[model samples]
Target: MMPLRTIANRVECEIEIKKSRFVGVVDRAATEADARAVIAAARMSDPAAGHHCSAFIVDSSAGDPLADPKQQRIERSHDDGEPSGTAGMPMLEVLRGHHTTNVVAVVSRYFGGTKLGTGGLARAYGSAVSEALVHARFLTRQRREIMTLELDHAEVGRVESELRRHAVLVLGTSYAARAVLTVSAVDADSTAALVASLTAGRVTPVRSGHMYAEIPD
Candidate 1:
């Protein structure tokens, strides 16, 4: 299976290169809209910053980023008027090098009195992101389908235990007239097989939607 990774949480850091201040932030963002929101928040926080350059990559397990990153992922970058290829492209390259998905990075630059050429600007912006990533926490997740399995009170305890023992993630549980377990499986066929074996064909699960959830490190 293709491994998918994401940020554990948001991170913020600052670095100074040649007297220029670079403030960088990284966060988990699965969509273009989410990435834009993060970029907007950074701009709002530092309205006076000289430039706010940003990059993002959003992908799924179905496609291999290494084979064709641009085609496989929603990849984008913006220099934010610093130069043609100095700020944004370098930040985007750093993210791609990290092989992380569903994440966004933004670097706000406050220029110092001195001027650094294009190469210097690129290095500063990229290093800013790299510095922030030093404090980032990462986690692996995979695509999983949600399912609901209802059982009488008597069967709930044993059935749920068996489900966990088999590595099925129990998303939620509710009890009323009966017990309903919202669980996750890799796919419907495997889920059906597991449920049949667990309940001896007496129960069927209703398929819901899909989601991404953490796996062991």
Candidate 2:
């Protein structure tokens, strides 16, 4: 699967444009419902603000087996009483230009007895979100195949060390009469090959499913 970029954590920034205060809040939103929740949270953050504009892009293929993982991107924008295309469109454009996905941005506007015309409002709102994103941390995520390897306790340490040396991400490990390890790899074939080589054909790995794993931005 293709790598996706999103905010590492929630971030907020405030900007003053022509005496009007614009507060921008950005967060990772993996679905439409998540985006709405973030919007609601933004509204609650500044109840007195006159306008709350929002934009989001979510991966529509998530949890869907037949969907085109990378091509199925969902985008939404809301002006929230600002001029038709002023607030939300520009915010959405900024996100698209940055190649960010599964994220939402909301800009709350508090009028300060001054009006920024259509163009001014667009620039202000867009800039507010852009500035917030600039200061925010980001993460890259990709779909990985999950597998479990069960082996004798004596082999656990050596196999795990070798897997780590090969850059495989070991999710967790459990102990019983044997050691059961949960790991994730970019593909199932690579995981099988690694397990076979590590155990010299004495152990077989079981495939579980796919999960989104975070990687460095």
Candidate 3:
């Protein structure tokens, strides 16, 4: 699966153009519902704002296994009462230009008794989002396999220490009849080989599943 870029934290920026105030919020949205929820929250926080224009690009494959393969991404933008192309599309273009996905940006406009015309509105909206993204921290979400290494309690600690030395991400260890060490792995083949070599064929790692794990951008 392809690695995607997204905001690491929610960021908001305020910019005034021609007396119109634009407040933009950019956040991580792992799913379509998450994107809509962020937009809704933005509106509720600024109920008196004239317009809450929003744009989002979500990689459907990151969360939904049943998502249509032909549609790997879900992109949406809304004008929210502004002129047709003045608000949403321009914000979306800025997001795409920044190569951001699984992210949502909403620019709430507070009318300043000034009409900036369609072209001005587009530039303001796009610029607002762009500025917020500039101050926003970002990360890359990449597909990683989660594996469970079942081992005897006595051997678990030593094995885990050894694995960590090899640069493996050990998530956690759960106790049961045997110790189960959950880890975010590079791949199944590499994990299996490491486990086999570590325990001399006494243990085999089980593939739990796959998930998109955040990494440094």
In candidate 1, list every pair of residues with a backbone clash: none
Q: Rate the local accuracy (lDDT) of all candidates.
A: 0.84, 0.86, 0.87
Report the CA-based lDDT of candidate 3 relative to the real structure. Answer: 0.87
Predicted candidate 2 versus true structure: per-residue lDDT over 141-196, tens digit per residue: 67777789999999899999988887778999999988999887886787688789
Please report the TM-score between candidate 2 and the true structure.
0.80
- Can you give the lDDT of residue 108 in candidate 2? 98
Compared with the true structure, what per-residue lDDT tens digits does model 1 show for residues 1-217?
A: 3575678889989998778899999999867788999999999999999899999887633433223333457889999998899989999999878777888999999988888999999999999888888888877666677899988889888988888887888889999998999998776788778788888998899988767675645
Query: Over the full model, what C-alpha lDDT does candidate 2 score relative to the true structure?
Result: 0.86
Error of 3 at 62 (Å): 9.1
Q: Give the candidate order by descending lDDT.
A: 3, 2, 1
- What lDDT score goes with residue 162 in model 1? 87
Candidate 1, residue 80: the lDDT equals 96
